[model samples]
Target: MQSLFERIDRLNGKYNALVSLDRPRALQRAREADLAQARGQSWGPLHGVPITVKDSFRTAGLRTTAGYAPLRDSVPDRDADAVARLKNAGAIVIGKSNCAPLCSDLQTRNDIFGTTGNPWEAGRTAGGSSGGEAAAVALGLSPLGLGSDSGGSIRVPASYCGVYGFKPSIGKIARDGLIPPLGDPAREDSLTVVGAIARSVRDLALSYSILSGEPYGIDAAPQHAPRIAWTGEFPRQLMDDEVSSALEAAYRTLSDSGASVEKVEPPLDLHFLNFKYFMLNMYEFSPRESSPGLHKLFWLFESARSVFSGGIEANYKKLKADQREQVDLFDRFAQQFDCWALPATPTAAFHHQKSGRPIPIRHRGKSKRYSYWHATGGFAFLANFLGCPSVAIPIGRDRNGLPIGIQVVGRREQDTALLRTAAHIAERIGSTMPLAT
Candidate 1:
């Protein structure tokens, strides 16, 4: 506990990864934990282990702003359900990590804590709104962090920082006290999920169990080769050479390890699915109310597309059927394949840029201008749209030495099995944890 505090004191200023810390309170709890241990008392698996949470999660007595100004001094008297579960499992929160203001943006920056720099490159972006959580985990400031993902928040940041992140099936982790809540909590089902970002898959598994009430099957190795399904490339998505090559190399490793890897296209149209995502997000999230320019324009474009395709009512029925098809098709997919493999994002971490601007994507003399969405799209939303489980595993790095990663997805409610498959692959391909140096 002292070591973690010392490291944060020494390095957090440089990274701005941690926004609010409860050092005094945390240290007291740590000492109490030590005394309990001395008396042979065990809190749980994570007893006395220090960890950090995304600032968006309300931690009892700890200030949580979600990077919004009005809530700067806000302190909740109760923990978010997921946060309480972590605390119940003996995970001590040393601090709260930074996030995008009100958890609205894709990059981590706000008036409260400035911006979170990528652990690999200071000038590049740390993906958000879970950016600070990933940066902290990667830089050894924290071993594990809780992140919320309605979009690509968890996986994108983990890929950017060369760490592991997991998003379990919808409602796998309770979501009562999250700031800028995405889905309607009154309902039992969810489109958003609370998940874990960690330096290793084992930590993610433990955290998942604590959060979801699942088994803590640590070091779960698949007994046989996994039947893997992957798109050689997603249709119409432009990717950097480095990112593409790294993924292809990972496929080679999985194949060499005896996995039956097959190239296949996504079962549904991606553009259509993305439109479904935007349509549903309109009601579930409120980011667009604050977002200007492109945010509004994207909504307008999708709305127009809906009208162009007959009408919203017509598409609503189509989408409802599509949702059912998503369930049925994926059930059969789960029977045939252990997991689906794909890149977490289209490119490796790029230099920090504004959200509405065009990004220059270049590789081996090929250069093109891409919108922010095109550049950041890593096929991540597929899992979110389908309510599937997804895990981002760092496989290699780009020429600029930034990390590259791929997400393996599993059927809804099969998070533990997917994680085990990921662990099996990690064991075969070797540990990809970034040196916190």
Candidate 2:
């Protein structure tokens, strides 16, 4: 544990993966754990294992800013429910990792903690808002990291950093005390979930079991071989050739392993679904009313107008209706297949850019640029919308040696089954790769 802290201290400056550390406390806990073991006291499964929690999770006495400058000094009186559960399992929280401001962006950068770089390439982004966690795990700074995913936060970073990330179905784990809080309408809707990022599928499974308070059960592989569905293309989205090829290779591996693989049309309109998702989040994040006085008066007027015109509420209802339709469609599709596979991202890690510009990709012999959100969230948002479990596992590398990942999605509330399936696929395809230096 001490050596891990020393390595973090040495490499943290270059990767900016961890923004804050509770080294003394973590070391003290480690010593106590050692002594307890020596005394024949049984410890938890994660006893003495060092881990980093995403800054968005509130940790008692540990500053959790969520990369927001105004909250730089904000320290919670209690750990987030998930964090507390992990602690109870004897994991020592070494530090808080960087995140997007308010956990809103796809890249880890904010006024409080500049930006986290990809462990494989310093000039590229690590992916966010769990980018820091992924980078830290990929660089061997931590064995496991706790992260949150509303859209693609956990999966994107895992894909970019060549690690394993598992987002369980919403409501599987308690959500109290996360930044943005339970009172926030966005969280009230349960779009975000506490998840884990790690170097192996087994770590994800263990962490999920500990954090969710559910025993990790094995899903017996089908005697007749499981059926897998996949889609390589998305509407109005451009996928890099390498990413597409890697996904295809993964499908071929499953097919070769006796799993029936078939190409299928996407069950929903991704563009419309993503658009509604963005608008819904925007409304949820927006202030309910302005400060008192003239601003408050104007806010009242706007609220009244919206109420009379059936504005925000109407839009929200329509979004929910559409979401239900898509979820229903997905459920029907899942009934016919054991898992759905898709590209984790349109491309591998791209160069870090502050402007939040559209990312360019060549498709069908033409060059096109997609907004960063759409590029990364295209395949990932569906999981959140449907409240389903998904796992991202590194498959292979691109020409530039950047890691490529494929996502395996399962039915809602079937997190353990999804993890088991992911582990099986990982073994079949040899998905485990050495971490980047």
Per-residue lDDT of candidate 2, residues 343-400 (tens digit): 8888899888863588877666667887877777777887888889999989999898
> lDDT of candidate 1 vs native?
0.82
Q: After superposition, how far is residue 4 of candidate 2 from its true place, in Å?
A: 0.8
Alpha-carbon TM-score of each model against the true structure: 0.92, 0.92
Q: lDDT tens string, model 1, 147-216?
A: 9988788999999899999999987888789887533433233467899999878888989998989888
Stretches off by above 4 angstroms in model 1 are 182-189, 218-223, 292-318, 363-365
Instruction: Give the C-alpha miss distance for residue 265 in model 2, angstroms.
Output: 1.8
What residue runs in model 2 are displaced by over 4 Å at the alpha carbon?
182-187, 219-224, 285-309
So what's the TM-score on candidate 1? 0.92
